[model samples]
Target: MLLYSSVGKLSAATCSGVAKNITLAIVLPRYNTAYPWAWPRVGPAIDLAIKRINHDPNLLPGYSLCYVFESSEDDSGYCSDSIAPLVAIDLKFTHNPSAFIGPGCHYTCAPVGRFTSHWKVPMITAGASAYGFQEQKTTYSFLTRTGPTAKKLGEFAVHVHRFFSWTKQALMIYDDKKSDNRHCYFTTEGLFYELQKDNITLIHLPFQENAEDLDYQQLVQMIRMTGRKTTMQAGIAFLLPKRGEGGKEGKNELKKGKEEEIWRHFPRTVQTKNLTLAVVLPRYNTAYPWAWPRVGPAIDLAFEKINQDPNLLRGYILHYVFESSEDDTGNCSDSIAPLVAVDLKFAHNPSAFIGPGCDYTSAPVARFTSHWKVPLITAAASANGFYQQKTTYSFMTRTGPTQNKLGEFLIHLHQFFNWNRHALLVYVDEKIDDRPCYFVAEGVYEQLKTVNISVLDTVFQEKEGNVDFHHLLQQIKSKGRSE
Candidate 1:
């Protein structure tokens, strides 16, 4: 069972001569039905990592951590509504947690970053990759990430453009409403500027808003206006809008609206082998059982909806490339055998092969490997799952700092301030949802308790809307004075 306390400091219950307690908080961005993909695999991955950390003695000597999981379930109307309440709740009721992790999306990260900055708390972001969260400029102590930044993605696009020699008169499509779109635009613009320095003619077409109800007629008219003689390479950025309260309703509406507007009017040019459609999203093989059979359905469905439009019926190639694993053999020999027996309850199939890229198999794969001595490696998962393990088989080999590192940094901060007692705790209410980050916080809390740290207060906050910060601050100040 996942135990998360909203208020009151964690304490050792000395039962059966075994005393253990620590408190850590995890703040996650609340997304409505519109943003399902925002945290598709992050929540589960974080939970598994925390479970491993708490059970592993090598990670924390005697500590058993407790977690508080909170979410800001903001809808499209109010992007930061869920996160705003968390800031107030964290400031008021949460114990001075050893560390904080999350606010996964870039939108929520901005507000969380501001809140943590004031307290000098070290925040580790597993998903957010906003523009200013880098080490040099941010006031926060640390900002770690598992995903590539938009700038890196932009540079890659430019490299591809140069390699293909499609530098002359390129038409660029962008979404103006989202931060992600802004990042892509700025990054792509920078790349285009550099390409222009080499005397390459670059033509940019900026499209405001999302692809929903896109002005396909205007787009087609513009294409025709450009004339048949002047054929320019195009770079299109498709930024999806945030989902609404009615989950499936919003998606269906978006599909129907997009089909009437953009997809319907696109020119049905013959399938020119040279005209390539490059997607910036991660590329996964549809052959893998986990991804191919599961996530593939959604991708295919989305495409099917797109193809329903007359213009998109003609062949339009969509090519995608994700960061490949270090070992890209399409075989799961080293990883899948144990998972089949222990986790999935499937007999080991020698004929089964692994996919070329890593899927969301990191957490369950890591759990079976670490806790049960299975031999598997997840190349794509970025969560801190494998850190702080004694067994090589159970250890995570992916790139990124472990929760142990974040805990150690917090410990160092406590020592730096000469703070020995009177710690407070604040965490999210995990009962709301089963996100994995809650477990990571719990693991960190356990580690702090093992080291004899005393927590003064713990609080759980709502996942959305306005949070009363003034009340939380008053509580913290009162607790500090009493201590």
Candidate 2:
């Protein structure tokens, strides 16, 4: 399960200047079941995201976020008996919420659908990814989701099948409990049709083959006496919640709402085959501040294309999981690369490491973790000479151009403006236990020298980012150089 909790400090804060706060109702459902949540920190993660948005004045323009955590009883599959009553009773109707978030379980979304549809309130959920909710849009007029959809899940399933080169498999549905069976029913339909189009044979069942180990040797020896069957090379089980809730009226009425309206829209296609993609958000990379968030969608787009055509990646499916990376200078909390890699190794066991973005953090991961076995793949991290020391750092690979390539860029810029002499500004912080402060400066100087650029002088700052360039500007003027 994804267990990281994100930045959610100011989720309920009212901006200092904003007189009125926009309220959102957060509905976290407590499903009475044995299966643990895929990500136990879903609630905190949402709060953290909300806090991030609230603090960014440019994002919302005129809003301070106010939200109430509403825990509703959704034990039974029937919505009216559990969810509907609690939503009506728990939520403050007078101070109308601008929107409602969550009801994470697939079954709980039904009541939110009814309420949101009736009041025309916008609803957002991070989970509850059942398929076919879009067909009944009138009831789910204002719903959204930040996670994957039923069709995407189906496509992902197809990708898994394609990855294994398996033409035959069992499709397990959770129809044992009527209320809890909605997800299984929808998943079965959605995936059945998708796989059916691909000419894959699918047998529907209500449970996993490993439900018990009662198989006898004689039964296997007879080629399955009941019927002639090809080997079931894979099994795709839909393990969704089911407690059997709501009567015919609930299904016909409130269940019409879907998570599709909440957010996230992607063009869908089924790709063949499967493989795992692991990524670490480069949050600690001081050089590229905007890199972290883009990784998620970038992975999405890559897989989207691969999945669109079964033949695009003929024999494999691509799956991606990303974890936040950090160091002392704010990459991600408690995420010093080496330790984080160890945790990930035991927990998720990624096939490869996508990145920590910057060289400082990526260096440790490649040097230590990748050497342990998993390869490290990165789009950035052009600094710190991994390419020059290729044999020494054999496991590290760059998807991006080298840092020396920047000299070519500098040469282009120099040619464009007819610039000649350059003065280098380097950050000097000799505070570490024993290491030298001018780590990046030496490399920068060498790259410039390699490109035949003449350096007029090299100036030093007390720290990397604490430069007061006004004094340096005066000295530059004394030297009478502009470039």
Candidate 3:
């Protein structure tokens, strides 16, 4: 089913003021920003996304999909110096932006996140790809990014290293340049973190992003000095860096030409010989550990069971390319886009995608797989919404949790406690603009009603952010004393 998000408690009449037509605002970099070439491409992409969404008859029927742009004369999308004007433009009452797109740079998105988190307005970014965004989802509840995220890059590095059984890696990164270009900087940082978890030692190599002209001979010599002896047979250098020459380019961190020179120096793709399953997960997500130790072990147990019988399976060693679905919070609609990316990067090489592991993640992920065409097999996620969403979520095959079971569970709870009275205490986000949790509260209220329990009262949190449940507690006490 589509995510039934109820943004606010607006009456049919008053709602006309805020959402007469669905308008999506975009904050792109100006033509004269840090990367002039990239900004031109960002405009067309936003236009195309708007066009596709509008043409879809099933989506937003009777609602005109309009967009507003927010950018300065020569501004790059950054957090500290940028995004304030963008946020101000969006917050305007005169046809304020219903949602946001663009301002795709990591620096700009950080501040944009601050506005969205406080206001509760949904935003989708096509440009930014920082790994830190996933860790800040609770702070930026409304933001969703289509990314070349740090986690995705890290996972790709881990996959290649694991395939070759390499225990040490040279952590190559561009020198700290303009803050606007931090997306590239953080990607290598994320790659380093992922390697550390696998007990791999990473040697740091600081290079430049725009390495146009540099001494190729010194760079080559630096590689040899690091311990990895280079045999230049063709255009490609087929060796990982030697241990001692790790920081050979240390003093030469002055230019923005590291990555380009490295590619101009060493290039070739690595290939593995195993039957691979690219399992998409949120392993880099410490907020949710459901993917690794939770569903990861379950896959192992199944494989172990299969390994015991030679008659059942022969001549095949199944291994998993565990790809990380970068997440900030539990809301993983953003995570689904990266699976499409990583899948294409390997030419749809994954056997299948395993669990996203909860209702929050699987909701959006299930819908995307219809287009992604990869089989999404969920483990711990038992949302009853799955079966009804079959048409939209065609690629999904779930093996846990059901609404009927939850219905039975609620009845059992009342039976055991001998307390027939029931109610919901929903603490809404004080942001009157909109809150996504309203639908969740409605779902719980309906489910509780189905189990034949009478709801006496519904408690809402106070405007100051804390739940004022003292009165509700007193009522429960009074009811108990009377009974």
> lDDT for every model?
0.42, 0.52, 0.50
Model 3 TM-score, 2 decimals = 0.37
RMSD of each: 28.9, 29.2, 24.5
- In model 2, the runs with Cα more than 4 Å from the true position are 1-18, 30-56, 73-81, 88-92, 157-175, 178-189, 196-483
Q: Sort the candidates on TM-score, descending order.
A: 3, 2, 1
Per lDDT, the best of the predicted structures is 2
Model 1 clash count equals 32
lDDT per residue for candidate 2 within 1-483, as digits (tens), equals 111122143234344465357777666543433322222345556567768888787877677776765444433422222343244323535356788776655656654555565567788776556654444455456777677666676677678888878676553333233445355555555565567668887653332233343343543443344323322222334433222122111122212222011122234336433465566654434445435656666667777787667676666666666555543344332113433454455555667777766665565566544335578887766664676667446777788765556655666776687766667653323332112224345445566666577765534435436566887777566553473
| Model 3 ranges with Cα > 4 A deviation | 1-19, 32-58, 72-94, 172-175, 205-483
- Of 2 and 3, which scores higher on lDDT? 2
Q: Mind giving the per-residue lDDT tens digits that candidate 3 earns over 1-483?
A: 222112232111121233347766555554554543244666666567667766786767766576655452232233322232333332333356678765666655655554554456777776446555655555556778775676677788778878878776543333343434544455555565667778876553333334454556766566655523222223432222211111111111111221111100111124313455556555544445465646666777676665555564465555555544433332333333232323332454555666666564565455545544768887644544565556667888877655546656766777787766664444423332112355344444556577666765433435544445687677556544223
TM-score of 1: 0.36
Worst 10 residues of 1 by lDDT: 245-254
Tens-place lDDT digits, model 1, residues 1-483:
111234333221111235355555566543342443233345566556767777787976677665555554444423352233344234324355656666556555544554454345666765444334442243333455656654455456557667777546445354344433144433444444445555666553444433354686787576555523222223453322222110001111001121121111223347522212111111233343333344445645664565556465346533221112111233222122221222121222111112222322344334333433334433334333345433422444544335565666666766677665554546433331123465456546555665666645535345535567677677677665333
